[model samples]
Target chain A: MSMIGDIARLPAGVPETAARPQVSVATAEDYVALLKPRVMSLVVFTALVGLMAAPGPIHPVLAFTALLCIAVGAGASGALNMWYDADIDALMTRTAGRPIPRRRIAPGEALGFGITLAGFAVVVLGLLVSWLAAALLAFTILFYVVVYTMWLKRSTPQNIVIGGAAGALPPVIGWAAVTGSITLEPLLLFLIIFVWTPPHFWALALIRTEDYARAGVPMLPVVAGAAATRRQIMIYSLLLIPVGASPWLFGYAGLVYGLTALVAGALMLAFAWRVWTRTEGKAATTAARQMFIYSILYLFGLFAVLLVESIAGRVVG
Target chain B: MDNKPDPTELTEEQKRSRRSRSIAIAMVLGVLVVLFYFVTLVKGPAVLNRPL
Candidate 1:
């Protein structure tokens, strides 16, 4: 609160009315935007798959509690990200309309909202699930906001590579929330997302090259050029194929999931190949966009297959 | 500051909007509190067994 009060005194349109700044009433939709609901949905789904796939079954309420905690924690990270990136967010055409950049929510309000949600989620998870899960959730939020967004994003082109760990932690947290410990199974899931992040993100970064460059964010495409980025995307895609298949190879999943992984992996590689092979303007951008869109489906399909297989296994046996 | 509107001088419309926003935020907070109670109930052992 004091920090927000201090920000109010600055000339950054903090509203000179020190007693009560005239802020527009933020709508429910604005709050939802702050939560980055799209990203939160993915987090919830992946975490749910993790929870369901774990060895033991949990009470329904506790399971829902854990999922809710992870969702809130992910949202908190998004809010903090918006808070810090408000400056650059205003610069980039892609992000110029985000809540903070558009002045729909004040930076201080965002920070407070993020911190409060994060604290509440962590505490509730610890009390309801296990301290270990809560700790991982807390670390995920901190790493995403402080380490990735604040430090590496602006400093290094390898930002997503290192920062991908935060995104990868959800399943592990979910696994821990259920089992109260980490295991090889959840670690394999973690590796899949970890290896998948670069190609998935770089494909989009390829098209948003100008936006990143204008924002002064050192995305791989902006820093290393389009050709190099394309090559790296292919490399990561190749690596992803095997890792994506690991859950199947390890016997953790059945025929349905195995086939899904194989097909998804092939399509991912083929698209990345297209991205690499195409050298022209619109064609190359189109390829990258195709890869980007397919990458989302690939991940979702892979996880969906896993969830379905797990449910079938539970019912059959 | 001149930019700060006095709460007492607020028009009826402004006051109504403020009241609605306040209620919405309060409702969200209340729901969260209810959720906490449910969590505590579900994991009573964990919540109760933790050493203060």
Candidate 2:
């Protein structure tokens, strides 16, 4: 297939997932979407960093199982979020086509599925790994579904900022899975995800302001206007520079990761500035879109640098 | 006020009361189903402890 076709076929993302829920029709892919596989990807990647960076060794089979539990937990959160948000989702154009909203799957069934996965994930992680990890996983699901979805979402513009905390916990949970303790390094990883979430979300909010407004969801863009949203994006982008560098500053990673972070963060802020200056249209949306994509790469590169540096040290010895 | 009741009248008040009770029962049952799914299916006791 042509590259453009590939891009065109890509899912419109979480917002759209709720729009045509009934269109999903109980396929394997439908179940997969319930897992929010795309979100699970980044969760897995970051949690792997925590697993790898832990002080001691983990048995290989057990390590695989622990990672699996984390992935399952993350998936459970996605399903629950979908189930809970289906009501407002039907009103938003971006979300109107999702499985529940579309009548492809029943809302009660989605809730059952999510609740089942949530319990399964936590119990397995707790049994196979540590209770600390399990507890964190449980909290992550609760925070996402209840604290964020049911409570904070329509109540305030600061929803994403507070809700972002749940997303940031995975890596720490992964680390504690191995060590059964929390530490500064995992906290650094948590900080990175936390700082990264706002700009990441707001970029999409900029693109979908009208949708959020229609749903009465109170996203930053819908509440604050494009100009204010751009200002916030740029503000977060600038702050990300120092936050992204924490791993290197604290000595968890090497010079390569530090240098890469410095360059990537500068580019991110520069893009955010461009976004801030643009008159809203294709140009503004494109810049916001680019920042959104780059954020993912920025995270992947940071963690990749950590793995590469550690491996190189071992090989050199 | 004084009122005389027919032996078997279907009053609006009685009908409305029945409908509200039905809705309340359904809501309770729905909540229970969701809670049960979490406790029994999702977090079953077998998975809570170490493998034998």
What are the candidates' individual DockQ scores?
0.28, 0.02
| Tens digits of lDDT, candidate 1, B1-52 | 5775553354565456567668878987897788778877776767677532
Q: What range of 10 consecutive residues in model 2 chain A has the weakest lDDT sum?
A: A16-25
Model 1: per-residue Cα lDDT over A1-317, one tens digit each: 23334443556644434434354556667777999999999999999989888878788888898999999999999999999999999999888989999877889989999999999999988877888999999999999999999999999999999999999989899889888889899999999999999999999999999999999999999999999999999999999988998999999998888888998999999999999999688999999999999999999999999889877876776
For candidate 2, write residues A1-317 as lDDT tens digits: 02222333546563432332122225444566678888998898888888877777666555666777788788888888888899888998877877778766677778887888789888867766678888899999899889999899989999999999998998899789888999999999899889989998998888888889888899988887888888998899999999999899999888898998899899889888888887567998888888788888888888888767755654564
Off by over 4 Å in 2: A1-25, A312-317, B1-52
- For the second chain, the TM-scores of the candidates in order are 0.66, 0.61
Task: Please give each candidate's TM-score.
Answer: 0.89, 0.78
Best-matching candidate per DockQ: 1
lDDT (0-100) at residue A265 of candidate 1? 98
